[model samples]
Target: MIPKLAILRRSGLLTLALGVFFLYQSLKLELGSWNEPGPGLWPLLLSLLVLTASFVLLIGNSEGGAGSEKKPFAALLRDSRLPLAAIASLVLFIVLSRYAGLTLAGGIMLLAWLRLLGKEKWTTSIVVAAGLTALCHVLFAVALQVPLPEDWLLALWSAGR
Candidate 1:
């Protein structure tokens, strides 16, 4: 296996290349003036951010400061449990959202993440999750009128009515 530093450098290079690709694609899109921002502006800005961060990561890890030793891939996976869990939970949320709608899926995701990953107390996690779910529902569904997908529960309720 490659050294951790080498892995990081390679990842940084990959990210930098992706950012450059995104920058090129975004530039090809129609970017309106500063006052009337077009579809491309947001992507362009995000690509720039990615480019900058990858550049910084590459520069910072150029020399061995810390965590530069070679370790097995298994060890790397073992050390990244939290991040892996977060990613897994995010994927779960995405799958759940398709069926459960944003509100319910977001609530479940928040509760699980706060309680399991964040190690928050049950009451605190439940309360915060519910609150955030409500806030998100109001923000996107009510205020922004985002036309979220119809939840199975909502469909059942309407059917019963």
Candidate 2:
């Protein structure tokens, strides 16, 4: 049988650490009245939940028998490329958006990501990128009243209007 103790130990440690961190953050925030929800309420509740779960896992592990070999770290590393690339692209998008405008920056980031990570066809990438860029433009600019960076191209286009 698989070792319950090993699972419990790992899960408990993670939970305990997360619980402490959340509790610290919650204490730092203004909790306000119980009648109306405050910023600190969610984190306080989550921390309590984590603490309880960690204790349960620790107790269960003590009662269960340990079994099986540990999985290789290489197995975890195998499928990380896509996430790494996506994170890098997101960072790049943030940097580029300051100069290139949200529409252009977001469009390029989406195209590159879809093409590189998703291995999407050019037509599909173009369509998806354009659609997403347009959606963001409408949402942030029109609906949310948040102004996007005006790049040279966008500035020229707006000047003509």
Candidate 3:
């Protein structure tokens, strides 16, 4: 129980520290009006909420029982593979998007990630990847009229049309 409380304390402290850091960054940005919230507003509020939650956890742990058993930190770290994989996939998507354009890159990234990291079925991965690509195309290219990257492969396809 003591070990558990200690772990909780450490995690809470880390969260609180991150919250403070974000709060400081947010303070540097202009917080817009209530109706027209600026980019910093959401981050500021979220950091505050995180800080408050951390504080609550820290305080609660101080008087805790039956949570003293310490779990191995190595085990905790090892169990974080899925999150790390997801982050890696996002990084890969960003890098690939520059060369392959949004739709093709996104589709390939989603399919590979879902199939490999998520261990999803091939059919499911294909369907999901295709759906996500189409949805993103509609949202960014059609609806928002945002200009995504134009790869030579897609250009050739367009030229043939």
How does each model score on TM-score? 0.55, 0.50, 0.52
**In candidate 1, where is summed lDDT lowest over 10 consecutive residues?**
71-80
The lDDT for every candidate, in the order shown, is: 0.78, 0.73, 0.74
Question: What is the descending lDDT order?
Answer: 1, 3, 2
Q: How accurate is candidate 3 locally (lDDT)?
A: 0.74
Off by over 4 Å in 3: 1-79
Write the residue-wise lDDT of candidate 2 on 21-74 in tens digits: 879999888787789878998779878987886666555445424673433432
**What lDDT score goes with residue 52 in model 2?**
85
| Top candidate (TM-score) | 1
Give the alpha carbon lDDT tens digit for every residue of 1-161 in model 1: 77766766676677699789989999999999899999899989988987996777577667654767533332433332454466578779989998788777888999999998888999999999999987887798789998989886556656999
The prediction achieving the highest lDDT against the true structure is 1
Clashing pairs in 1: none
lDDT at 108, model 1 = 90
lDDT of 3 by residue, 96-138 (tens): 8787777777898899888987789999999999999888878
